[model samples]
Target: MCFEKCARCIGIALIPLAVLSVVADILLYFPNGETKYAEKDQLTTLVWFFEGIVGAGILMILPIVVFIGLKDNDCCGCCGNQDCGKSCAMLASVLVALIGMAGAGYCFIVSALGLSQGPYCLTELGWQYPFNSTNGRYLTNYTSWSECTEPKHVVTWNTTLFSILLVVSGVEIILCFVQLISGLVGGIVESCCHCQEIVRCNDIEVNVYEVQE
Candidate 1:
């Protein structure tokens, strides 16, 4: 009963996948910031590049997953202990919470990182550099829509979006964790109380029998 109530069957496969999805989503939230620094440091750029790529992946698939989850769940999602629990609701809750956390955590990290460097200055990446700088400052005016519109992260945009997403995601994650833990604890407490009551009843029966004898 505990196992059934605690975890869902449908989610066994989706949880880890959702984690990857979220990681990707957060990475892409600010692509401009990522590419700007890639020009200076290969290693940092690599990390940033991966982050952006992952974020993009999440953006692509998250909506589909959410739609499916919504259709399967009740309003409270995985909050249901019995009827709803067996449904898609509980699984959805867990997924949503985890995804939300991933986005939120990234936002928090980016905002904190911003203190060290000002908003990602595309100029620093030499895109804004002088004379015939085709990639940065001039690329927008020159390149085709593909090059011009493709993900070019802006630090300012990344910072702002990340910060907001983080706070919101962070809060939701906390609530989800709290709700989950509390439910478990409540079950434990109820079980213990039942056991104690059974022991008390047994003791009383023994005492009465001994007195009669």
Candidate 2:
């Protein structure tokens, strides 16, 4: 009973984590044009975009797996000594969770590395500059910048967006680990509970026959 409750709680927790990740992934597409950054970063922006798509897809599916695991647990009682369904569900959920965790971890790594290199990229792309003589002691208009309409603004937005993605990925990785452990441990405990239930039912049936005799 406790295990089931815990599984449900874990499932509920994964919902928001997954949603936040997907939303952030979608938002990552904007803030900086894909084509523009794809050129300089050796397609790092494209990589990030694809990673977002994959992360969002995995996260979206994660909730469904959790729900299925919960459903399997609820159905355990009805299945009555037959742990096939529940076992299969647990295994499937665990597999999905592992895959999701891997994806989330990859995203976290990429986003974090991007954060480290993003400032340099901004400078290289003319989004920002040093305190050099040309840029300093003199005011410059937006027209002076190339590659982006408003280079400074775009870079700021990009930096903020990447930071958000990094945080979201980190949280998701942690959540996925939690869910993974819950599913594995819960599956084992649930199996033990089902075995006890089966034995108890058999004993009750034997007692009933003796009473009838």
Candidate 3:
């Protein structure tokens, strides 16, 4: 029951994280509040991957639903046994948590790569990756961000949004792993309790028969 509560809390927490990931990914397409770069196909390639949207956002929905549903008392009514039904639900939750973790991991990886590679923007020469050669040193060197003359501070935009995705996705992965462990523990505990209840019932039935005899 405690683990079920934990799962519900985790599910609630994931909602905001998923929304933030989608919002951040959407913002990546428009640098400095301008859409011209996206229109001209000058946005960073990583944005096109939809890592935040598909990986961290949509992919997490199923797990969230399962986790939240764990709180329902009659979720397993179709199984005809409450304890057995709960065990099945917990097992399902464990599997769904793995899927959520995978999605968050994908988003985290892509966000890191996007940060390291820097954004694609227009410079004096032409449209290209000016900071790609700097080995991510451009992140700390504020003066170097001036290289991307177009998109009006694209480096900062990419850095902010990608960093957000990185942190958010990392948290999501951790939460998913926690849910997975909790689900496993809950299922095992429920099964053990169910077995003990069955044993008690059988013992009671035998005692009554012996007294009647």
What are the lDDT scores of the predictions, listed in order?
A: 0.41, 0.57, 0.91
Q: List where candidate 1 sits over 4 angstroms from the true fold.
A: 1-107, 114-121, 124-153, 180-188, 207-212
Could you tell me every candidate's TM-score relative to the true structure?
Answer: 0.38, 0.65, 0.96
Deviation (Å) of 133 in candidate 1: 24
Residue-wise C-alpha lDDT for candidate 3, range 61-82, written one tens digit per residue: 9988888878784455536998
The 10-residue segment of model 2 with minimum total lDDT is 130-139
For residues 1-213, what per-residue lDDT tens digits would candidate 2 score against the true structure? 454455566667666666776666665554455545444553224345555556644654665466436654544544554465565555456776677777777777766655444423334445443322242221233342333343335545544655666676676667667667776876787677778888999999999999999
lDDT of 1 by residue, 1-213 (tens): 342233333233334444543554455333644543344542222235333224323432442354334333445533543443333343444455455446434544543343223223334333331222323233233332222222343433443444443444344345435434433554455446556777999999999999999
The alpha-carbon lDDT assigned to residue 55 of candidate 2 equals 67
Q: What is residue 152's positional error in candidate 3, in angstroms?
A: 0.8
Task: Indicate which candidate wins on TM-score.
Answer: 3
RMSD to native, candidate 3 = 1.3
Q: Which pairs clash (backbone N, Cα, C closer than 3 Å) in model 3? A: none
Any runs in candidate 3 off by more than 4 Å, and if so which? Answer: 73-75
Q: How well does candidate 1 match the true structure in TM-score terms?
A: 0.38
Alpha-carbon lDDT of model 3: 0.91
